[model samples]
Target: MKVIGVTAPSTGSGKTSVSLALLSSLNNSVSVKVGPDYIDGSLGSAVSGKPAHNLDRWIQGRDFMRRFRWLSSVYDFAVVEGVMGMYDSGSPVNLSTDYYFRKIGIPYILVIDVSKLAESAYYIAKGFIGRNCIGVVINNFYSEKHLIIVRKAFSDHGVPIIGEIPHAEELKIPERHLGLKTAGEMPDIREKAVHFSQFIDFSFIDKLKDIPLIPEDRKPLLVGGGNIYVAYDNAFNFYYGESLDFLGRIGKLHYFSPLKGEIPENPHMIYLGGGYPELYASKLAEKSHLNHALKTYSDQGVPILAECGGLMYLESTFESKESSLKFPGIFGGSVKMTGKLTLGYTKLNVLKDNLLFRRGEVVYGHEYHYSDIEDSWEKTMQNVLGKGIQGYDGLYSMNTQGSYSHFDLMRYGKRLSGSIAKFMR
Candidate 1:
């Protein structure tokens, strides 16, 4: 498989442009998002008209190397958009995109915010360069002179000037909490893409024609012929395309929806990914029967893995389109929307052994949540659960696992894969 990595000096610089232009310029390429970023994933997926897979070492695991290999199996080219910086701003932790990139031996496109610095652009790019770095894309350029000098600096290093994208007032992505406003919130996101597409040089997309996509080896690392139920409904839809494909190697996939149809028959696992459950709370509550089925599945010891919005659905209530709505209350908590934004990257360690991940094993992940679930005296004591480990504090908490960390599956290679494998057992 041909793979290209897009990274920048900092967040919101213009790696999106590099990714969009490149992926759009590819031939049926698959997009893989690194870190716990969702906006870039949504944008990249839309660019290729394919589901983008998230490979976050924190959310996924260290041993998940095989999962990455498994994910890009059939794709001709894979574009991985990096998180914050190429190297960890803090520590050399598990699930970092850079860690995964070096592990997978994939080349990348360095995008630097050259709005201020001229030759320094080349310096930042050089500092973060690797054997995997293909070239540099100078993004968010402010002046033509700066662009010229910046281009020349890279030229001096023999680095190809892939493309230079100027800053535009219109292309700003809307944000709330930690992640971009749920893709659903901005119905006009397509317009933004179209606008960016106009100014973005699509030639870079074509330049990647011969780039190699790293391929995956499908070996049975998990239990045999596993039955995996992937969540795909509007309520819980932040699942990684590659995650499912990787899991598919060891099992049969049965997709069940709480907003659309019935749950699949007797499956070994129930997968609930992340999404805006608050946006579809009414619909989720309407499907009381489905909720009951989920509760039954959980009671019967069917492995259920949920994250963010998926976790919210498992709770008792969430405010939505209709009045206050009630759900399965499988884990028993009240999910409420908050005007305050709670979002950022995190390092979560598994405190207790569970189906997914091992104790003290670290996973590099992110959490962007706009809702709050307060602990009640009765529920906390009765369930012996403390808001079920999520967000930043409880990010690395215990069993039948999940969190608000909307990270890419690639980041948490081994740890995430092994952890999830435990649930299948």
Candidate 2:
């Protein structure tokens, strides 16, 4: 299979847009994001009509390579999109987009935004020119003269120009506080992405060599038989595709929307990821029956895992500019929308045993949210790394666990399955 990595000098350089174009133009292709970004992966899935997966070394550790190889063997072509800038390091040093692309032994294309500059674009591209760089794609260029000047400047360094994309407002995706609007919210995003994809020159795929497939070393771990209720909808859709796949292997994976007043029956475990619950606070608040059902499930000692916006939904009240609304009241605290943004990779020191983690186990995860909870709530985990509230996280009650960190359950493998097995028994 042929693997291509798409990166840029910085964020908003049209990496996702270019990735969508590549997926739209390619055959039997799937998309992969380098880090823990749920939004871009959703966009990729929308365009390719395939489940997009994430490959993060910090979160997945050595399993990253195994996941990459498995993905390569499944599809004819794969387009991996980089998180943030190409060289922007993660929690540890040298863990960047360029690092992963080089490690995976794949050629990457650099995207450059040339909307404001012409000849200076060459300097920007020069800094990123090195090993594994296949070529450069100029985005948002103005005119024929502008494209010509940028092309002429790149001739100095002998950097291959892959394609040229002109400026078009129609191609841009809308954004909110938490990055781009999800593909589910934008009904016509796929059509727009297909139209925008025409600008990319996909002939570069012919020059790339195929990566040999590796043997699948391990099988997916399955817990005891039971139904795992997962919250999925516009209000709560931030979940990893691979994680969901793993969940399905464990048991029956059922999806219900809290916004639509739907609740699962006889659930062995309940998983709530994260999303824009604040946007639909009023609608979610109206679901009194759903709230009561969640509270009853929590009381029954059913293992419940909630993160970020999911944590907000379980609170007594969610206060935003739109409205102050009531929720499931499982946490006995209120969540308020804040102007301050807490965003980074997080390391958690578990203070107590819970559904997803063991006591004293250190877990690595990512946190990106704009809401803050009252400190009066009980905390269960201490944050040894990254910015967590007052050096602590994880709200605990009965068998339920809630936190701001988004965990990649695939990293835990059998350990997670074992934890859920205990609850199932």
Candidate 3:
């Protein structure tokens, strides 16, 4: 199998567009994010018609390579899109695309936006020459003339110009505060994928060599036996596919929408993920029956795992920019939709044995939100990496647990599954 990293000089360089386009160009190829991104898996899955995996170097560390190799072995080719710039390090760990490439000894392709450059684009490619750069893909080129000029300039600098994508308005992906919209929300994603594939040259990709695979020794088991109701809708759609996959392995999953006032019936556990809940605050608040059912479930000691937006929905009220809305009032707190952005990787040390974690066990996660919880409740996890709710996070009451941190269950799959099993017992 072949594994290649796609990176650019900086953000908004069309790395994601290029990666999806390349995946569309290849046969039997899968895509993955190099770090912990909440949206990539949603978008990548829409593009490739398969589930995408995240290989976070900071969270998974050297295990990323092992997991990556095992995942890549299942496909004919694997495309890993880098987060941020090519050489940009992590917030706390020295994990970057360059670091990953050198450590794993894999070749990568550089993507450069050449809409405003000709010969000068070669200078940008020159800096990444010896960093296992097999080739470069020029993005945002105007025409064939623009593509030819940039290709010749890079070829003269001993850099192989693998492909060139044109500047088209229709090829743009919609973006929000959290970056691009989920692939499910994007219109005609397959058509956009086709447009992106037309610009890439697959012949060069075919000539590249293969990388040896690493064996996967850890066997994933179905430790839990219960019915899980996962919140899935436009307002609460942020969840890792691997997490749901593990849930499915252990039990059956039933999907419901809080926006539509649907409640899960007789569920062993409820999962409320993160999304644009603040945007639909009034609608969520209007679902009185759903809110009451959730509260009653929590009151009855049915386990409920709530993330960022999920946590916001369980509060006393949500003060959005437009209006103040009421919530389930499970916890005595209010959430305010703020203009400031809070985003980073976080490590959570469990303060006590809870629904998703054991006492003293550390869980790595990502948090991106524009809302803040007001009242302090029983803190369940201590933040060791990013600033989370003034150093302490997670609100635990009865059998309900909520937090702003989005956990990657694949990192702690067995423990999480076992916890759910123990809870059901």
Q: For model 1, how many clashes?
A: 45
Report the CA-based lDDT of candidate 1 relative to the real structure.
0.65
Which candidate wins on TM-score?
A: 2
The C-alpha local distance difference test score for the whole of candidate 2 amounts to: 0.85
* Each model's total of backbone clashes: 45, 0, 0
lDDT of 3 by residue, 1-425 (tens): 78778888888888888788877767777787877786866777777877787767666645677777777557877888888888887577776877777777778888998888898888976776664787888999898888888888877767777778889897888899888988758858878888887877777766678877765654656455788899998899888776787677777889999989998988888999999898788899999999999999999888888988898889998876677788999988989877899988898889987777778888888888987788678888999887677787888888788888888666665555555666677
Order of candidates by lDDT, top first? Answer: 2, 3, 1
* Candidate with more favorable, higher TM-score: 1 or 2: 2
Global lDDT of each candidate: 0.65, 0.85, 0.81
TM-score of each: 0.69, 0.95, 0.93
Q: In model 1, where do residues sit more than 4 Å from their true spots?
A: 49-51, 54-61, 64-73, 91-107, 112-135, 138-160, 166-174, 181-216, 220-227, 261-268, 319-324, 338-366, 375-425
Measured on C-alpha atoms, candidate 3 has an lDDT of 0.81
Please tell me which model should have the higher TM-score, number 2 or number 3: 2
